[model samples]
Target: MTSSNFPKAERLLRRPEFLQFNEGASKLHTQYFLVLLKRNEGTGTRVGFTASKKVGNAVVRNSIKRRLREFYRQNKSLFISADINIVAKKGADVLDFHQISTELAAAFGRLRKKYA
Candidate 1:
């Protein structure tokens, strides 16, 4: 089953069948999270978050994933036209929800301007 709740738009995903954001995707270092973004192709942007055992036990990793997913869920609409992915780096395990959300919003704004 497909996991995306966000709708896809052709102009941003199908029109550009390449991931150009790798070279320029903004990186935000927060006290609790590290967010990475890249533009990709498909029906819509696919997002994956990775939190290794080094961050903590399984519980910690899962918590980080949930926060990351929620961050994307709340902000995905802002970039409804773009296929964007946000990955959580090692630092993300330590972050609180509000901090992660703020970082995500800022990153989205930066990407919006770049893609525009």
Candidate 2:
């Protein structure tokens, strides 16, 4: 079996280690996100995409998750070795994949710049 790029390590979801990004971490919208990055602990940069019921029905929520996953998977190298949780906001569902991808890419690029 192929190894999973998005591994569920302790840094991503463990309690007591929550490190949310500043207002700048979240861009293009008010949707807040938490990023926990480390140098050498996990295998690779794993990410989790979340969308609550407030967004819409199951279809809409899954769509958002799919877009986020695609955005991260396609551009995995752009991110550092950490666990990331992407929370969805009100306008998330209404936005298209291309739009979301652009925002996500820019946001992720910022993260990469921090390490570089």
Candidate 3:
């Protein structure tokens, strides 16, 4: 099995952490998700995932979160030092894995200039 290398400690868990990222964050929008990003103090990249009630029920939300995590895991070379929060938008719950990955890749590309 190819285990994910993502560190649990790098995840934004507390409300205050997420709140901090909310202010002055650069955003990338796609059909399936909205990616909000802020340059981070930490050495490596950190991330968080959120899906509102509008997205779907618990099962659907978890599915989106899983897809987001998988995208991040595979695309480490594209990242900068940042705190990223990905929020599932309407219709995201129904997206296939390839669709989700495509949107995520596009979002990362869009943020490249900003991160530099």
For each candidate, what is the lDDT? 0.61, 0.62, 0.83
Deviation from native of the Cα of residue 4 in model 1, angstroms? 9.7
Rank the models by lDDT, top first: 3, 2, 1
Candidate 2: which stretches are off by over 4 Å?
1-40
Indicate which candidate wins on TM-score. 3
> Model 1 over residues 1-116: C-alpha lDDT tens digits?
23344344322333233345456765655455555555454345555566667778899889988887777666666553433445456667767999888777776676677666
Alpha-carbon deviation at 82 in model 1, angstroms: 5.3
Residue range with the least summed lDDT across 10 consecutive positions in model 2: 21-30
* Candidate 1, poorest ten consecutive residues by summed lDDT: 9-18
Question: Candidate 2 vs candidate 3: which has greater lDDT?
Answer: 3
lDDT of 3: 0.83
User: Each model's number of backbone clashes?
Assistant: 1, 0, 0
Mind giving the per-residue lDDT tens digits that candidate 3 earns over 6-65?
Answer: 777668888998898658988888887888888877656888999998998999899889
Please give the lDDT score at residue 36 for candidate 3: 87
Superposed Cα RMSD, model 3: 2.0
